[model samples]
Target: MNTTPSYRTIAGDGLWSNNLGLVQLLGLCPLLAVSGTAINGLGLGLATLLVLLGANLCVSLIRHWIRPEIRIPVFVLIIASFVTAVELLMSAYFHQLFLILGIFIPLIVTNCGILGRAEAFASKQPPLPAAADALAVGGGFLLVLVVLGGLRELLAQGTLFSQAHLMFGDWGRGLSVTLLEDYRGYLLAALPPGAFIGLGLLLALKNLIDQRRAAVAKAAPALTTQQANTP
Candidate 1:
């Protein structure tokens, strides 16, 4: 068995093939709800990334001792503990953002992205590879959250990082970029329906790109064969 996954495979997993948001479609509840604003999405995504890394490391470390029958429960318990710690820490330090995030903070424990990594990769691998996989998967999830959040924020509010201080400290309060002074916020883009529409459009775009790539590959073989035959 190959112990190491290649750099190409890692990049593909993080960017496209096993993308947490567009492909796995995990953690949609928090992904859709908090993605109304760029800062909100960034905050949530970073927290999730931390939790995933911690959980993956713990699971990988204990993979040998854990029996098959009890592994899932063990993983969930570990994840839930980390999430609770994160929730409390956020509430204490970033009270405003914590309130804004609300239940979604706790909901991170149940996110399929974290749990899936524990079951699929960490349970079988050593600490280093498992950590790498967690990073790739978590990074992928964060990429989607940030992109969707940026899109929604720009369209709905005509601003980027409008409320950065809510997550970051006082310095971030003035970090917002105003794209339009006389802008009317689009209610549709800030709503749940908008998330579905945006996600669907993104998925469609990805599929279209994949199809084009596939077509080029298919045509290349035919063209090469024809050229060989002609000569």
Candidate 2:
């Protein structure tokens, strides 16, 4: 069996090769639901990042003591505890935003991304590296959420940071940045169907780019071979 990978490998895997949002496609329910606005997405994404980091750290620290038969349950328990803490903190501090998040906030316990990281990476690595990996994965997931949220918000409302004060302080109330005054909001872009459609288009665009890159790589080899034969 291989030992723990280097930090560079962990970062690359979490950010790209094994991205929780884009590559692995884990945790779609909340990812789709709470990403309607940038602030909503940012709140949930930050909460998830905390939970992931906490869960991974706990799992890594205790992996050796836990038996194979009971490991999953232990991991779940650890993750659930973190989720509960996050929920309570949100309710106490950001009550309005917490209410808006509702069931999705508690549902973080069931996110496959958290459990998958626990079993796949944390279970096999040390606490420090596992924590780093969680941060990387969580950051990548947050990036996707924020971008998707911004896209939906811009298309649907023609404004960014419309509700910044909900999560931030009173000073943030003035941070609402309007993109267009004459803009007519796209109702479809603010709905559930719009989230799905936007995500699909984003995925398609990523695939198209990958395909184009591959085609260029293939052509480069063929061109080199033809030039070598000509000379």
Candidate 3:
């Protein structure tokens, strides 16, 4: 039997079981800092996703040439190169959202999620699986960031997708929805504390869901055995 993990297993790990945000808890800095609004989260999330895909593919392609002693530095250089490219692309195309993302855009260099995947999985795998892993893991982070941002924005301003023009161009301006007209915003949900509280709630929900799934999986075997014995 082949011991190597299949593409599906790697994707599953990245998307859910070993998610960088909900499970591994990597990349919290960007995750929490820019998630105050849905648009902000989306901008940064897309940037991170692009960087991850590029870095992972590059690392996997060059893994054989990388020596163990110098792998860390090489990985950093590769990731930084990709991040800079992404930053420049954003600045050129989405100048407004680029400014809004600010320092965090460059800060993708230090995102443990990217570097960790490069070291742990990408360097040891082929380009295709590495790319798949990047898609799944980056997607998972993007999903969490967007959800958290939307939740915080809804609570703080009673609006969803506020400032739609940042990422989506002028047409995005019409995307903002007012959930409660003339409603007072919740200040806490817009603050750093709000990020922490919101993240904690999300973590709790993820754990609850995982536990339920595990319980069901555990009972499934027993059910199958009992049905077979009954016959």
Candidate 4:
């Protein structure tokens, strides 16, 4: 049995075909909660990415030694350890963002996406592929967070990257983009319902694109055969 998955397959799984945030719908708690703005999402996303990368690498390196009966606990420990390190790092550096994220920072340990990758991919694959998988998965998650956060912030506050200082210091304060001038924002977009509605719309958009791609793929062979026969 080939225990290792190819880097391409890993990329496909993480980025598009089976994204942690979009496809698998994992980690929605923090995804929906703290993603009220782009800065908040970026901060949490980076923290999660850091934890996933570390946990995946560590699990791959030590996978052979862990007994199957205790693998779950071992995985949890590995993930929790990395999550703690990330939380402390954020607190030490980006104190404002850290305070905003609060318990969700520590709660990355409970994100099934990180643990799932460790157990499913990292545990079976070599370190290189494991790392690739982590990057791909983390990248997909980061993209979703940024997009969703941007959307919500734009709708709620007529601005993008609001409070960028929380993540990027004072210089980042200038990164905020104003879309609407002298206009009040939608109240719902400032609430949890906005996250749900935005997520649902995003999911529908992805599904629509997927369906179109599937239709094109399904017709290609038939069209090819018909052309050959006519010729």
Candidate that scores best on lDDT: 3
Residue-by-residue lDDT tens digits, candidate 2, 1-231: 749888999888887667788888899999999899989999999999999999999999998899999998999999999999999999999999999989999999999999999999899998999999999999888887888898899999998878899988798789888998989899998999989987887778767877898999989999999999995
Model 4 clashing-pair count: 0
lDDT of each: 0.88, 0.91, 0.92, 0.91
User: Which ranges in model 4 have alpha carbons more than 4 Å from their true place?
Assistant: none
RMSD of 1: 1.8
Q: What value of lDDT does candidate 3 attain over all alpha carbons?
A: 0.92
Q: Could you give me the TM-score of model 1 versus the true structure?
A: 0.92
Clashes of 2: 0
Q: Candidate 2: deviation at residue 26, Å? A: 1.4
Off by over 4 Å in 1: 223-231
In model 3, where do residues sit more than 4 Å from their true spots?
1-4
* lDDT assessment of candidate 2: 0.91
Please report how far candidate 3 places residue 114 from its true position, in Å.
0.8
- The CA root-mean-square deviation of candidate 2, after full C-alpha superposition on the true structure, stands at 2.0
TM-score of each: 0.92, 0.92, 0.95, 0.97
lDDT of 4 by residue, 1-231 (tens): 656777888898898899998899999999999989988889988999999999999999998899999999999999999988898899899998899999999999999999999888889888899899999999999989989999999999999987988888889989878889986998898799999999998899889999999999999999999999995
Residue-level lDDT of model 1, residues 1-231, one tens digit each, is: 637677678668866888999998889999999999888888898889889989999998988899899988999999999999889899999899899999999999889889988998888888888888878888888888888898889889999999899877899979999998999999899999998888888889989999999999999999999999995
